[model samples]
Target: MRLFGTPTSLKRMVPRGLLGRSLLILVVPLVVLQVVTSVVFYERHWDTVMRRLASGLAGDIAATLSLLHRYPDPDGQAWVTDFAQEHFELQLDFKAGEVLPNDEHFRDALSEELNDSQNENMEDVLAQSLSERLHRPVMVDMAIFARDIDIYVQRSDGILHITAPRKRLFSSTTYIFVLWMAGTAMLLFGIATIFMSNQVRSIRRLAVSADGFGKGRDLPPIKVEGAREVRQAAQAFNLMRERIQRQVAQRTEMLAGVSHDLRTPLTRMKLQLAMMGDSPDACDLSEDVAEMERMVEGYLAFARGEGTESASDVDLVEVLETVVARFQRDERCAVELIGLYTASGERRQAPTTVRRDSIERCLSNLIGNACRYGQRVRVHYIAQEDEESCSIVVEDNGPGIPPVLREDVFRPFFRADSSRNSQTGGTGLGLTIARDAARVHGGDILLDDSQEMGGLRVTLHLPL
Candidate 1:
């Protein structure tokens, strides 16, 4: 059942990192247990102890009063005072003419502010106990002196002022109990933090290794040094990496052999067609052979996405400028770079680790396709520092693919242009190859309508 806030709001309040959440799990219960223990101790054990201490002090005072009443003469009263002070450790003083002050006056003259609720409770308990025993108005102030409690009792003659040691009513065990609880809690929390950090370190290493691997960066196997579950995950990741590498190696080797074999026949056909040039049938046959060769090349490029290229730290803006420059040389279409500068008008650089060849090829395909379909193409580079990513958007003012076919156009040999015209499109593998290159580096290509250009917009997003 939902309680305080909506589920979404509660989720936002929760810690996003595993370590923070784990520590919270440990701390919350420890805090709750300590709170409950303190409440129970104060409610039952501590309260009972305070009451007993107050009652004992009140009994001593009542007994002293009784002795004073018995010996009303001056010499007798002085002896009783000496006896009470020696036996009960109380300093007694008598005022024959002075009457007990009113509540407000007494509070102003004798009471001092207490530091905590415990002292206030102690004062209340002692005052209630004295009033019950002496059958007279009484005022108790613990804060009047550092080590003494000032208690005033109203009598018919005057007032009996008693000075008792603060230790008689205040328990030292309360502070000891609280300090012990806090010290132990802090000790346990520190221990848990150390152990939790060790466990989280292993998980963090695994996550970083996995992210690098996905981005096509080679990394050594991670050390499995955490709990059983974390160790198992690291083991699984290592095994998966080995299996995928083996499969890719096998596929590349097989395709290499096929490419070599197919090129020989195509080369012979091209030479044969050159010898029989100018004949209509030979020219038609040469065109067919060339089409076959184009299709074969497209298939190989698609299968060998990134091939064996190593990733390196490259400036993405430099790569985009190179591609744009190449397209600019072509008079068939006009291309422009929109975002090569920061908002402050200084030149910007996007430095990230990526396969340079793969990214270049991907950009070539996307821009080449746009230039082919439209007269003007605009390339926008958006660096999203907060997201730890960047995007290269290629927009063209061409008749964009319909919403339904945008996804289908990414399939190999599936062209939006149904005419199968070689002048318009080649083997329908351009988008497929571009997407594969992007995905090889743990990025993706997305197609949407361009708000500015009113045509197709292709955004290639890559992690920095």
Candidate 2:
């Protein structure tokens, strides 16, 4: 249910990406299982094997020393060394005047990176194994040599120095075990990634279709495929879309019926007024009928909406220019474009998809309202660096709408007073239509005081 993240602490620790989070989901337990198995291996398998081997070696050394001590002659020492080498596979030597040192060196049999921790733990394991069996203190040096370790023990006469391969202490098979575990984790992660990617793709497609629907654009039907939950969601989306289509069709039909019924009566009223033309009473009635007709048309326009137009890429720069040009021909107040040109050069045009005529109508309504109420109008485009959206602001210098009534002005046929109404000559549907059009494109129209114009500024924002 949480989109951006889960619980706050986990949200921060985990990566903010789909694949990264999925891998973390897979890898955390894999690492846990590997750690558990490794601990078991060291405690049960590795320790048991090393202890048995070290015990045998320690017994052989004790026996050989006993034989040499019992004889004590040069010939007896020579015969003990030769016989031990041939029979017990022991490489033993005596240093007549030397003694075993107090200090001992430690290192891992395998990796150097693990030396610090492995060296201490392994040295303890080896020393304990030797002492428990042989009942003698042994100096274990695993670091001084590359592939072998030196064992030194002092007797009353001299030091017995023995060299042994480090493999006797630890098996190489552990490395193979680690490699296999790592390979299996990666394979699981890869399989999870493939499935997750497919599921994510389906969700993204559903989101795109929903966005397009909100923006009043018709998109192809989305395919329902993925897990059971995703398929159910897609099915619900299809049903909702169908319901909306049916409602739109019914509304369109009703509007057509209403237009036909109302216009037939108006046509007759107009014809009757024309036959009684020129008389003062008749002229007044004609004016009233014309005003009524205008009101009816405004209502119909607002009801009809932007019509069956599809969205397309529109150049807002050109739209603003054309609207200004049309106002100029009508001899309205001079309107200038700001931010469209800069001292460095012409600004880059930001492209956005919109219903062309819908935006045009919205702009024209705002511009006309501005020109009627104000002497000067300033239009500008604002495109921020991130480029998520663009803004078209039309500012005019005139008596601005009161802050309280600004919102009220957008209501259908809600004129503030006679002075404002007579001057603008509107049914008060202009702002309503403009705002509705903007909203359909996932944009909005906002009215505020223009700092430069000291009047109303109507800003229209459309997504890019």
Best by TM-score: 1
User: Which pairs clash in model 2?
Assistant: none
Alpha-carbon deviation at 363 in model 2, angstroms: 2.5
Model 2 TM-score is 0.80
Tens-place lDDT per residue, model 1, 220-242, is 99998899999999999999999
- For each candidate, give its TM-score against the true structure: 0.90, 0.80
Q: What shift in Å separates residue 402 of candidate 1 from its native position after superposition?
A: 1.1
Report residue 378 deviation for candidate 1 (angstroms).
Answer: 0.3
After superposing candidate 2, which stretches have Cα over 4 Å from the reference? 1-94, 104-120, 260-279, 328-330, 341-346, 405-407, 418-423
For 201-309, candidate 2 gives per-residue lDDT tens digits of 8887888888888787877678999889888988898888888767877777788898999889988988998998689988998888888888888898888775567
**lDDT for each candidate structure:** 0.86, 0.78
List clashing residue pairs in candidate 1: none
Best by lDDT: 1
